[model samples]
Target: MFTPHGPSLRELAVQALSSVERGYDLLAPKFDHTPFRTPDSILQAVERALSALGPFDHGLDLCCGTGAGMGVLRAVCRESVIGVDISAGMLTVGRDQEPRPAEPGPRVAWVRGDALALPFGPVFDLVVSFGAFGHFLPREFPELFGQVHSALRPGGRFAFPLPAPAPPSSPWYWALLGFDTAMRVRNAVWHPPFVMYYRAFRLGDVRRELERAGFDVELYALPEFGSRRDGSPRCRMVVATRRDDSSQRREASHSSLAAS
Candidate 1:
């Protein structure tokens, strides 16, 4: 258990043995109380970075979860915002918890849909995701990005914060490495695997995949997170611009998310 309000250890173990969708459904109620929830600091930092780039007309929170990114969208996007996720349970929590804004902002729509088979046209000017990629296997990267490319209008951007990979010398690296190994072993013997591996989604590989998916990618350092000793950012935002070209179609590599 992460806290008194978070899921207990037994609950987590049960969720881990279930399918991804079902697992999230079980955790949906207490998701916000968990350390797994995207922290307010990260969300605020992302909003700060995006505000400089926009007055965006429309935005999508891919794998939206309990609608944390919805606030970010409301701050920057003018007309409307959409949050798409596979878990109905998660969506319910977001819908019921909608904050009454002091001033009315973007029209919020929460849709139940798969990120891989997104139910939208080239409708969004911006797509933002917070802390949701680890649920996907690396093999799904191409198809996942393809969906994001299709969802965005021409010249639209797919933006999400990416924390730098832990260095091999850091304790975090070994911790994540061990966690991933345990997950692999669990899934090997279990039916309906719960996929959550921190190290599996490599940023270097992700950047290459995004380019392949026809995105002109850019990385922006999130100064709020400061920098590593090597002067690289502790966290960076990946801003992948969508381009529509027949030649560029095999390209675009990208999420629908689990809450984390």
Candidate 2:
């Protein structure tokens, strides 16, 4: 559901017909007013979880639309924080709307770049992405995770909040299923397809992909979102840390000596 200031039905229709980048560009102005932007509650919950893992230097907000996740980075990171996104329009809004925090925070910057082809070296200590996974297909997980891994320094973390899958009995489950089905149909009939599927990003598959990308994955339960009937966390923060380079080299050296 959208607020009164959110994108109109006709505006949303036009955006849906365009490419993902273009659609977000068109929606950027009113994004915060829409449910699409990460809620403050979720952001606060993530911020709390990440605070214990801090004080990081040089943080990145991947696919950082409207700079919502950037706020979390500012609170936890000590040095500079960057927000990278593919939509120039979204970046512009973020630049113009970002406020100076009361407490001294990291220097903030925005860059327009595709998530799959991030234009950065292993410079960041932390990277956080919120509500941007649906734009990526299941097959793109390898490249996406690989890019994040590459952007992070050795032992740096790629963190994100992942909500538990909705149960079949819940209306949310059916709604999300129908939405994905509709998106598939739209893509089938349209050019420059807008990819967003709610059901595609599975935890088991994601953990495996993160592991394959050279990350030691850890899941921290976000108690703010509470638990499911099975007593499992309803939401979790996936903290995937790249291994230490020194430790990696030692292991490699040991392997070479053993082989010789």
Candidate 3:
């Protein structure tokens, strides 16, 4: 479901045939016009969630295509914001359409790089990614999560919003199934396959991976979307923190010595 300004069918066909980075580079200019871009509603909800958790210093938007997530970071982070993506073309568009100025409008920077090999130290206080997980395979989860953890300062957070899947009997569910099936077939037969898998990113799997990567994970429901048939959350905001255990242990040891 693309707008009139979105990529045409032929254009999409060309992109689908290319490698992921090249395809995204080709699609960058019109990405915001497509349903592929993270919706404004999700961005607003994430911003609202971050407002309660933050007042962060520096933020990073991982795989930040066209910098939609950067908007959320700009709202919450005070010092600076960085958007990193593999596509130079995407960064170009991101630089052009910068976030609006508010009180302490965070300085925005863009870097073209792979998510698996992020080129930054433990400098960021917050990291956010939106609508970019489909590009990564299941095995890549640990490495990606590790990179995010390593990029954050002690007690820094990495957050993302995930919506619950449609019911099995729903038309949307079947459509996604068919799409994923087609993508599987396409990748099986294609060369340098464009790697986008829908079912590979279950929330349980992600939480486990984040925990393994040393993040203390928590979920907060975005009440705006309401609940499911089982009364579970319809959408959740995942807030993962990188904790400094050495500091806590040292404090505990000092308190024990003082008590003794």
Q: Against the true structure, what is each candidate's TM-score?
A: 0.93, 0.96, 0.93
- CA error at residue 6 for candidate 1, angstroms: 0.8
Query: Root-mean-square deviation of each candidate, in angstroms?
Result: 7.1, 1.5, 3.5
lDDT (tens digit, per residue) of candidate 2 on 107-188: 9999999999999999999999999999999899999999998899999999999999999999999999999999999999
Q: Model 3 clash pairs?
A: none
Better of 1 and 2 by TM-score: 2
Q: Which stretches of candidate 3 lie over 4 Å from their true place?
A: 99-104, 245-260
TM-score of 1: 0.93
Which of 2 and 3 is the better model by lDDT? 2
Q: Between prediction 2 and prediction 3, which has the larger TM-score? A: 2
* Cα lDDT, all candidates: 0.91, 0.94, 0.91
lDDT of 2: 0.94
Better of 1 and 2 by lDDT: 2
Task: Compute the lDDT of residue 234 as modeled in candidate 3.
Answer: 91
Off by over 4 Å in 1: 244-260
What lDDT score is found at residue 151 in candidate 2?
Answer: 95
